[model samples]
Target: MTRPLLDQARIHPAALAQIGSYHTDLIAEVEAAVAANKVVVVGMGLNPFPAKARKILDGQGTPYKYLSYGNYFSQWRPRLALKLWSGWATFPLIFVNGTLIGGATDLQKLIASGEFVRLLG
Candidate 1:
């Protein structure tokens, strides 16, 4: 059976840890965004694995919107701390259910193992 769009989006806590943030507000926002039903996200920069990860997610029945890194950063600068730290510069920043879901590599690992698809279902 096919999984629902919202169900396809999931933000694992481990993934969020990859983001370095002393403030909890943005972290909470990321967690909430990524955990949301549709899992809308911005691909902040050029990354090696995001396309593959997106393909895997698409194949597994998850649908997502990819926002340009430049545009995303321009709009979300206040919430993000790229200048203050390295947290904002990371690629493949995922937002589902109002939460953050790490990078492409992590997502790829989860999908390859079948855990992500199963969770989607």
Candidate 2:
């Protein structure tokens, strides 16, 4: 399933470079973690959802790498970059084996259905 994005042609050439480089360092950090780890959860501080996701993983004895950014009171710009880059629009972006598996509720469903374990394998 492909998420629709603005056509590059629709964007001005001069702005493309800036858009490509926008907060790329943060995105690269998450990318590197996802590449190296079997499971990765990208989340922010002060958010219970990320913690909940972690707890679920813990319950399953699943070791995962977690990357936390700033909380509600700070660092929204950097977080925005993550949202735009991932197109997930929420915290605790969970990735399993280099594929995004959504957030906590989604994770729980996957686990209950046995797909989560299958994914790890």
Candidate 3:
């Protein structure tokens, strides 16, 4: 059988550094949340930031949701719709604790700064 991602029930050092620099307290908080059986949601698309974020979350065993239309929709289409109606599509929208993070870059910054982990709790 393969070894679990979290061996010895602890996070890997390199991964910890990537995620720990942002929020020193985040690891503890996430551990607590998981122990409590709370749900954490991650919303992202196929963009670079989302892809990176998903990678981190996967290692952490955190759950997330993906939202992307891929190459099927163009930016101007929203404008076209607005001319006909008043609706449009947006990007980098991430919601956690009922707050939106705007995009993957923002999440990367947050994770780097350590805020992402604290919020998981």
User: Using Cα atoms with residue i matched to residue i, what is each candidate's TM-score against the true structure?
Assistant: 0.46, 0.95, 0.43
Q: For candidate 1, lDDT tens digit of each residue in 1-121?
A: 2433223136466654644344556545444455555655555444555566577667767787665434443645633543233243566665544445567776777667875555555
Selected candidate, larger TM-score, 2 vs 3: 2
lDDT of each: 0.54, 0.94, 0.48
Q: Looking at model 2, which ten-residue stretch has the lowest summed lDDT? A: 1-10
> What is the C-alpha lDDT profile of model 2 across 2-121, one tens digit per residue?
999999999998899989999999999999999999999999999999999999999999999999999999989999998998889888899999999999999999999999999998
Instruction: Report the CA-based lDDT of candidate 1 relative to the real structure.
Output: 0.54
Model 3 pairs in collision:
22-112, 22-113, 22-114, 23-114, 92-102, 92-103
- lDDT string, candidate 3, 1-121, tens digits: 3432345348778876764354434334433443444333322333465566566667767776544333324443332322222111334345556445545566667778888888776
Runs in model 1 deviating more than 4 A are 1-36, 71-89, 96-99
Candidate 3 has its poorest 10 consecutive residues by lDDT at: 79-88
For model 1 the local lDDT of residue 29 reads 49
